[model samples]
Target: MELPKDPAMLLSIVNMKLRDFYPTLTTLCEEMEIKETELTERLASIGYEYDADGNQFV
Candidate 1:
């Protein structure tokens, strides 16, 4: 699927996917064929980072 181009929207979609489906960032990225580093970096640029314990970007 195409990821949101807006960082904020990307954060929302990623967190939603993590909450409703995947167990971890790695699994989500793997299943979606996304590059984990790129995803995290994008979100991080907007002051959000993945929190493994919560399985969401915070």
Candidate 2:
């Protein structure tokens, strides 16, 4: 699937995947073809942070 054009929407989708599907950041990033740093930066811009152990945004 294509990444969302809106950053907030993108973050929401990513968080949803993390919460409801994926088990790890690495796996999600690979499936989405997104780099960890880039995804984290984008999410951070929207006030979300990745928690590795929890495997979701906080």
Candidate lDDT values, in order: 0.94, 0.86
RMSD of each: 0.4, 1.3
Task: Encode model 1's per-residue lDDT on 1-58: one tens digit a residue.
Answer: 9999999899888999999999999999999999999999999999999899989999
Clashing pairs in 1: none
Cα lDDT of model 2 by residue, 1-58, tens digit: 8888788888788888988889998899998888989888887887889888888877
Backbone clashes, each candidate: 0, 0
Model 1 TM: 0.97
**In candidate 1, which residue ranges exceed 4 Å CA deviation?**
none
Report the lDDT of model 1 for residue 42: 100
Model 2: what TM-score? 0.82
Quote the RMSD, in angstroms, for model 1: 0.4
Best by TM-score: 1
Q: What local lDDT does model 1 show for residue 41? A: 98
